[model samples]
Target: MDTQQNTALTRALAEVPGPLPTSGVIHITLPHTDRFTVVGNHLAQHPDLSCTAVGLAVRIQSLPQGAKVGIKALAARCKEGEKRIAAALRELEAHGYLRRVRDRLPSGRIITRTVFCNRPAALLHPRRPAEAPPQPAKPEPAPAPAPVPMQRPAPAPVCHPTAAPPAPEVPVAPVAPPALSAPLFVPRVPPPTAPKAPRRPLPQPGELTPELDRAATTFLSDLHRHAPQFTLSEDDVRRLVPGVAAWLERAVRPDSIRRTLTDDPPQPLKHPAKLLAHRLTELLPPVPPGVDALAALDRPRPRFTVTPFQTCEDCDRAFRSPTPGHCRDCRETRAAYAQAAA
Candidate 1:
């Protein structure tokens, strides 16, 4: 595997806590079940773990009884990183799947390594099971013999005369053939498309007089707020009244123009003038003035600063730091824990 994937696998394996062995015993978890979950999930994503793990298991199996294998060498042979292999071994140890052995070689040098050869048959499931032996058949007993019978000679027979034969009967007439059925014709139906509904009448241009225009604009603003689903376009406005677009331009200075032609207004301003501003900024030709123009200038860069913090897991509390890092509760808890463990 690549370095990154190997690192991830290593980290995942390290998350497991257990021991590895050499023969007759398979690595496994003890009372705790969570370790199994982490290992199982890790293996699920990278099946290579199985191959590498099994390879290490096999290598350990090959070693002389009680002989430990170097973690580095095992990892190299398995084409996995040392860290990942260590994680797997750690997980195994944590789960009580395997036991770690530390010793000095005959050279009087210290040996710090792991041996993962085998596990208890109960813990390690065989990938391929051994075939069962053929069963022998049972023999049947012999049957008893039967008794034979004898036959006797025949006596003399008498003869009889024959009578005249009757005339042959006439042949029966054949029945008529069955009537034919008529061919059926089914009408073909076309696939369904959009439904056809009556169209609503467009609002009249004369309807948008100065006074009515104010009312429609106010009503539309209220409608937009309460019923956001319903949106009125510039065409809807211009169609309702003549010169409404021009009136809007004078009433409110929109960012850019939309080349929409309407019956009432020769030139129609676009709906969502802000959206028009963004589009104008992107167009090849120079965009209109206002927000878009101001945005064209280069601005100052933004800076971000983060305050330091400390956390106390024993108390499950967090606090912002005024000076340097220090959590009194965490330190006290760790000290107590160390003393207790010692």
Candidate 2:
């Protein structure tokens, strides 16, 4: 039953009459006067969304017919951190897009089911008076007087400008008084009969190094300058920084920019556009407790088996797939008509 529904959804999406814009919130037309929007703003805000959420939706929509995906299969496809994957599942469930059933194992770990196409009618076809035709956006009327005006003139000057001065001619004699023996120095008087408050233990000597202090300042300043769109919490800072909270207290510090460049560099990028982007490598801070160690973005690594591959169904030509599906060459030749129609 579930597979049949998935196949229907895939067909509906594949045969959609209009071109689907990928850049913004996607409002997709569904069967039975239903529509759904993949809110782009939400995705942008939560960049940490696991690939699982998106991949699951895509896979379900691509099913040929009568096929149901298990939880483990969905997780394997997502390739995201555990926390993010869980978050994505919860989000889908709360939005009525999924119905999760727990399948507990004897070992105490449980798997969750992913049910698509279970959205209630209330969400899919919400009725709200046709949105009142947007009211044609009437121009605003002139504003009434504000309770407090912005500017007012000062009152007239209180003092008169033309004043007269009087002159005196009489002179007086001066007298000096004699000083006695010098008085003894007085000590500071203590407060009398007051309850003494407990003094706090002197703050344990701050642990700071000169280099760390400078790096921290530079790190924060650069964040404000470059990535002004995003906000980071103290935990974020601690996580980003290698360990400079103590070093800032010391007077001596190294060149912050140099230290960061050496310690945490941006990943090596192949695309020209990505290379030209504002490098996050320079802004990394010392690693704080519980924070993952900072690593350069460009560090090379062996390609994992999870990397996708493709084989042409017609020509039998094999190709390394960057995305999903068969080799592009084979798809072009065999599915050309469908591709053009799509």
Name the top TM-score candidate: 2
Q: Count of backbone clashes for each model?
A: 29, 23
lDDT of each: 0.49, 0.50
Q: Candidate 2, residues 50-159: lDDT per residue as tens digits? A: 55665555555555455655555556765666666566666555544456556889899988754455223234443444454545768999999879756878888788
Model 1 residue runs over 4 Å out of place are: 1-51, 66-68, 102-117, 121-342
TM-scores, all models, native as reference: 0.19, 0.21
Question: What is candidate 1's TM-score against the reference?
Answer: 0.19
lDDT at 59, model 1: 54
What ranges in model 2 sit over 4 Å off? 1-58, 61-68, 71-111, 118-248, 251-257, 261-342
Model 2's TM-score against the true structure: 0.21
